[model samples]
Target: MPGRRTTTVEFVRGSVRGGRRRARSWLPSMFTLANMMCGFFAILVAFRGEYRLACALIALSVVFDIADGAVARLVGAVSPFGLQFDSLADLVSFGLAPSLLVFALFSDGRDSLDALGWIACFLWVACAAIRLARFNTTIDPTADKRYFTGLPSPGAAGVVLASVFAFADLMEGRDRLWMLLVVLVPGLLMVSNVRYRSFRSLVSPKSGKPYGLVVTVVVVLVGLATVPTVTCCVVAYSYLVSPLVVPVLTPLGRLVPDRLKEVLS
Candidate 1:
């Protein structure tokens, strides 16, 4: 026993061992619960007048929500319980939470509380419910995992949240009208057939010339950290318009492709 490690005889403490076993068993549920907690915390923040912080929580919730599913899939732990729990959490985080944020935008409106703005804010929830319902019903084995059928509801909510932060100062007196436009526009887009390219597939491909990408990422990070609200709005609005713009331009632009199309046609 001189230099060699000697194993010590230890008695099993059954209660302590069982407690740890139970805790480890509950890891996935803990993550799922955390997803729900994010939604609740976002609501609490919104009610407490922390609009930006509330929006940020919902955005984080979206990421956590995605991970919960991915984790379940990877671990082969998918269950009806988790699915229902996720849907409920999403309904609050992506639907109701953002709606309240939009409502706050009109709280300081010059005119009467904007009725249209209120409607637009809730529209996301309605559209989200519809989208989720459809998703549950249609289980396509052959569907492309790359692209979603319609714009995801979280993106819809993000557009509204981003607009709020982006134009925070501008929204002082114009809150009513601003919320009306931002909410309704993104809400309509969410239910539309317009297909937005999903960035989910962009994760794996590493560019050979990494320097350009690194610089691009650094510039973006700096811009975001410098003026988050404004940058978020610009980015969200750009994403909203892209799906609508690209399709329209593609067809018309295809009519004349600098003579190349003529030769091909």
Candidate 2:
């Protein structure tokens, strides 16, 4: 009887631990689902002509995308399922949603784009898909963690969001041709070999004090609060051109103090 009771207790404990693990695994998926929902609604709103709100939804999806990865890493729940799910969610949020936004913004009341515009928008989706696939298939444990092989989908979509917020009127009227550049340039960069710095370290630093990070975040928040449109525009476009600019600035990097570089890196 005593032996049977001890076995039963151990089994019960194992079951309880398994249940907790299962629950934790699902938490990251919850955030991914939220990200997908935001993209879905962004599409719906974009069609309804709520351009700003649609952009806002896409921005929110970016937040959820970041959160899901961070949460998955935090809980040790990173899995193949999560990786595939994240790419799918990214397709909806960063690829299709932004492409549709471009189409909607440039379309006349006919709910369609000219051939050039249509191709430009479609290019964004195609390149984003290719970028994600390349990332998955080329994963290397020994590869440098600090750089992504190409422009990330989120960064590509950010260019669209920033353009809409900063220059909606100009894009809608006299400078409408510029919108094609906005979509096309980033879309092409998505498939290029140009490396973009990954923010993983900034988001989840493995070492050192977080005070510099705190101050940086506070400054960014203040900029967003004070001049959101300009701030977003500058940040997004700067990143878009960073591949070109970074090479030129590489030599200058040594002039910066090590501590500041650590925080910014």
Candidate 3:
């Protein structure tokens, strides 16, 4: 009887542990689902002509996207399923949502997008899909994980969001024709050979105190609080052109403080 009771207790403990593991695994997926829902709602809102709200929803989706990956890594729940799910969620949020938002902007109250507008918006979706697909198929363990081969979808979407927010009146008027470049430039960059820094290390340094990171975050928050439109435009446009600017600025890197360099590198 004692032996049977001990075996039963061990089995119960194993089951309990297994149940907890399963629950933890679901946590990341919950965030991914939230991301997808945000994209879906963004699309709906865009159709209703709520440009700012749609852009905000897409931004919220980016937060959920980051959270899902961070949570999955924290729980050691990374899996093939999670990877595929993340890409799909990214397609909806960063690809389709932004494309629809731009299309809505160009079309306004018209029946449909013009030929150039259609092409520009479609290019964004196509390049975003290609970027995600290439990323999944070309995962290389030996390659530099700190840099992406092409512009990230979220970054491309950021360009669109920033343009809309910064040039709200321009995008609404006859001058909106030039806004096509906003979508076209970022869309093309998403498939270009230019490498973009991931900045993951800067945001979450593996070693040393995160004082630089904290300061950067505080500064960004202050900018957002004080001059949100300009701040977003500066950040988005700077990242868009960083591949070109970083090379030119590389020589000046020596002037940067060591602590700041550590956080940036």
Best-fitting candidate, scored by TM-score:
3
Candidate 1 lDDT over residue span 78-123, tens digit each? 7777677777777777778887777765765436666666667778
Worst 10 residues of 2 by lDDT: 108-117
Quick one: ranking by lDDT, best first? 2, 3, 1
Please tell me which model should have the higher TM-score, number 1 or number 2: 2
All candidates: TM-score: 0.72, 0.92, 0.93
What are the per-residue Cα lDDT tens digits for candidate 3 across 39-129?
9999999888788888889888987987898899899999899989999999999999998888877877464347778888889999999
Give per-residue CA lDDT, model 2, range 1-265, as digits (tens). 9999999999999999999999999999999999999999999988888888888999999889989999999999999999999999999999999989877877743433467778999899999999999998999999999899899898889999989877765654535667899999999999999999886866776656677677778877898999998888877888888889989999998999998777655
For model 3, name the residue pairs that clash.
none
| Cα distance off (Å), candidate 1, residue 86 | 1.9
Show model 2 residue runs off by greater than 4 Å: 109-113, 256-265
* Most accurate candidate by lDDT: 2
Residue pairs of candidate 1 with colliding backbone atoms? none
Question: Which portions of model 1 show Cα errors greater than 4 Å?
Answer: 1-29, 109-111, 204-219, 245-265
Alpha-carbon lDDT, every model: 0.68, 0.88, 0.86
Better of 2 and 3 by lDDT: 2
